[model samples]
Target: MTLDTDPGVAPQEEKLEMAADLTAAKEVAATDIPPELVAQSFGGYLRAWMARIRSGDSGVLPVLLGLIGITIVFEIISPNNVFLNTGNLVNLFQQSAVFMVLGMAEIFVLLLGEIDLSVGYVGAVGGAIAIQLVQPVTINLPWWLAIAFALVVCALIGAGMGFLITRLRLPSFVVTLAGYLIFNGVLLIILLLGPFSGYPTLCTSSCSGAQNNSHIIYQLMWGTIDPTVSWIGLAVIVALFGGSMWWRDSKRRRSGLVAPPPSLTFLKIALIAVIGVVLLLICNANRGRGVVQVVGVPWVIPIVLALLVVWMVLLERTRFGRYVYAVGGNPEAARRAGVNVNRVRTLAFALCSATAGIAGLLYAANQGGLSNNVNGGQLVLYAVAAAVIGGTSLFGGRGRALHGVLGGLVIGAIYNGLYLLGLAAQYQFIATGIVLLVAVTVDALSRRGAATGARA
Candidate 1:
């Protein structure tokens, strides 16, 4: 019998055709799947987030929960429940700003699996330069110019340190340690030998230490924007935040990629709005003494927020950011991928110092002036604690600007609450040490779990 006419041959050809058709049908079905349906509801979002947490991607959940716990505990322990008072909250924000900025500075280097010990004194030097330039007895440059000069000098200093690390293969820890001492001495010399030394009136005694009370620098922290302007600015911020999030999700969905649920997006926006409104209301309240009324949000809050936004964008939405993660996660792989590991590290260090400079200015503003006695060493330690506590891994490749803010708030709350309860500095130190240890422990455990899961 001819093959074409054979019954077995015909059956085999039919089976082959059927299998091809089935595969084609499956391809069509997959293409037709709607991406939005993947996470379109609140339940779906929650489930997805739970999965992520299980995978050791907890993000800010721990920090947020810890903050809540701290707040409640403090409120319960305080005699008058002053921990949650509006005025006290305002002060908490002011206190947190310095730490937040410093924590952010540390994040830049920490993200590269490196550390910058010099940020504290680097910042002091920046502030000293700015104050010296703008002081009446000194060069008396424009306030803005003074600030510009300060930032430039700090940036250059950072860049130079970066060059040495990248070109000579020096350890960042050692370089910055040397910087810590050098800048500390430099700060003292600036205060004692220059115009600051001659101006007896400028150097005033304060509780913390000796300070140079520069009117311009002091106002930067204490000054307030108009209430109307603050409201308008806040509205704009909320709108932008919501709109950006919505746009991102929409784009992902349109591209047939999984996006966060709409419900989750709205929840996030609502939470942000509530927080902003509450902050505005508290700041708008007259928290002044018996005769004077201090109203409106302090200028420093917006400045900090702006910097946070800028850094977030730089980290999340830029080529440099991707490179940073790559280098942090695996420097060898990054090198093979054509990433200039040295340049990235160098720039990271520079950025870290520049951020420290900004923090120094805020510190000076808060203290009423730059002081020779400013403890950069202690501040650097706090910055590291803040970043680590906020969820940034010491091993690098995982962190955000938001971590700094959240962590700084936690540290600030502890300090503020203790002061309110009349607790000694020793208690604050012990409490902070415990918190840092817990955070580090959690980080190590989570990383280990992630590694195990991957291996499996």
Candidate 2:
């Protein structure tokens, strides 16, 4: 919604948008056009979508299909049919909270055609700081401050690495690699020097008045919303979000601007409502094993969803997002086009690290503690893998926040399904590597298709 273009360009874009809408109204067979532009009637929209797919603009289709296929296979094969059990499924997603957030973190830099090898440990460091700060012996900062302080430090670390890459004219890979090594050492030292030595855990079950801060941190992952409250929240969210979306599209269409057909917009809203209902059903079901009656939507679900929306808006609807895309697509061109390429890159990295800090916090919450045993190297690998698998191109300038969630679900499914089958960590890694390879291949093909279209 934020325009970073000249006044003259605004009128031209408006005219083009109106023309695109008119073409859609005619239901014309358009070639080499943006798929969104040919979305007047449902039939034309479908055809345009098909054409786009044929041109290798697969979006998340492949991954979504893969996820479905994985779910089915695991449901049939896992021992005791527990793979698809509602309780187990909810727990699997809870475990995937870390992977999902980290994948999203990587997308920020990946969109710029850069890499951050240090985010895994950097996030771990943030979590460690959060834990250390609430200790009875240390600074003992408040919970909110602890979380804020950790994210801020992580952002600073990312900014420093990005600064090195932009100002020193260094390779992003090398700079981030060095950062990874440095942070790994730093993480070890923080864990070792702490009062808890190797294990610093959040206290929840037996927490007293003095330990309320620790309890709050622990509840982030372990707690759940009441079923009634969850349903009410879901209704409010759907109505507000859906209403806003419909209003925006209606306004645009009324003005003859580019917008999805009315039918298509309504269908999208209905789909969102249906998805929300399904997820709530899964979470609201009885997940407890005995008389405990543990049934409600996991707190992590809304937390991750909120973060996803924040990232999506930042990357899709803001001037900074455009600058990132422009720089990633071509830094020289972006610089020539009046963007401060270095500043954009640095800010992107800062945001990426801060996001990773959120993942770290969630990780700590899920595990009940911050420990030195975390496989940060593997974590970073999975983060990047999830982003790529979700259709983010390593070549950059083409990705979405939603892709990370989808990709993380796929990875989480693989992990959960394999573990249920008694497979080892090595097997999980092998499976993930294979999937990542396929995703990279698809990305290359997609890039080729887009290039071919441009040439045509």
Candidate 3:
């Protein structure tokens, strides 16, 4: 028997009926949906998050716990507890900038399940270019131009290496290993050919006027923000970040998309605000010795944060970023989906190299010059360790720029604390290796758990 209903009669009732049907269907299919997608409130979100953790997506939890644990250990054991002292902590951030940037560079390749061993020397080469050009003697270019030039050259180097890997279909390990040898030779030649005994330095205290180029580069690693200005900047940054989070979440909810509950979003904002305030308080403290009063945040802190923000945007917000994950997770699937896998791989390598170049600049700034004495080999190993320790998967397709930053901080803390404890560099290396091994183990177990759950 067939019964027909009028299309024009009781239109509002029809919509209501349809809506109810849709809701019923959603309820029936709820198990198929991600818990996070189905959650509509803060408590539900908590439960959903817990489920995810159980499924092996721990996110940044390990990094946070490890960081806190390390800090406590070092503060208790280091000579006079200087590890947590505000002044020493600030220095730790400065020293870590290089590692952070290098780790970030490595991440571009790591996410693609590739590696770049040449980063240390590649970055050094870029740093040498910047220092060489702005020497205030021979190629006295503006600091900004010199920096741009260095970055461009570094990017090209990366692109070249990427081309060799993609077009030649050579294994990244082999290409990058060869790149390491080639770049190291290039760095030596550049340093040797230039003045300063394979070390090029920016003009010292004598820098002035146009020669301020060197001074500016130097300040990137050594300068501090004015106290009042630092406060203003922090306020601006917090407002922007909080507003963006709120807007995005609100927008998602309004559009009937998957989003965390409002309370959870607000809580996140609040937590971020608290962290910012604490950081500012630490930096604003008078860490100066005797009569000298050193207060205000170090320039490196903001610079590193800015780098983190930029890279995060690239990886999380852009289509290219999605493609990156897709390729890393499964290149064959990504290729079938119309992604330009080769192009993405090539660009990833280029970006990785450029990032390494930035780390090189940081190293140069930290050392007060570009010197052949720079330990590119050790630096590369640390960069890899930092990325892995920060919880980036060695198997690829799972990580973030923040991971690199946190890992770098962990390494820096260990390095700094070990030195303060009068432990040898070898001891620091051993500690880092152990930490990296633990991180990898955790990652492997989590992945296995996830696979088993999926099978079930």
The lDDT leader among the candidates is 2
TM-score of 2: 0.91
Tens digits of lDDT, candidate 1, 1-456? 000100111122345556767777767455654444365566766665566577666677788889899999999998799888888888999999999999999998888898889999999888878777766665767777878888888888888899998899999899999999999998777666455562212232242222333555676777788889999988998999889978987787678676655666677778778888999999988888898988999988888888998998898789998888888889999999999999999888888888998998888888777666699998998899999898899998988888888888899999999999999999999998898898888788878867765555
Query: Residue pairs in steric clash, candidate 1?
Result: none
TM values, all candidates: 0.88, 0.91, 0.91
Candidate 2 local accuracy as lDDT? 0.85
Regions of model 3 farther than 4 Å from truth: 1-37, 204-206
Write candidate 2's Cα lDDT for 1-456 as tens digits: 111111111122355567768767787575455644435786766666666666667787888878889999999999988988889889888988888999999999999999989889999999988887877566667899999999999999999999999999899899989988999898888777667867888886988877778778888898899999999998999899989989998998798776777887888888888989988999999999888888999899999999999999999899999998998899899999999999999999999999999999999888888887877899999899999998898888988888888888889999999999999999998999999999999999878876765455
Which stretches of model 1 miss by more than 4 angstroms? 1-38, 198-214
Least accurate 10 contiguous residues by lDDT in model 1: 1-10
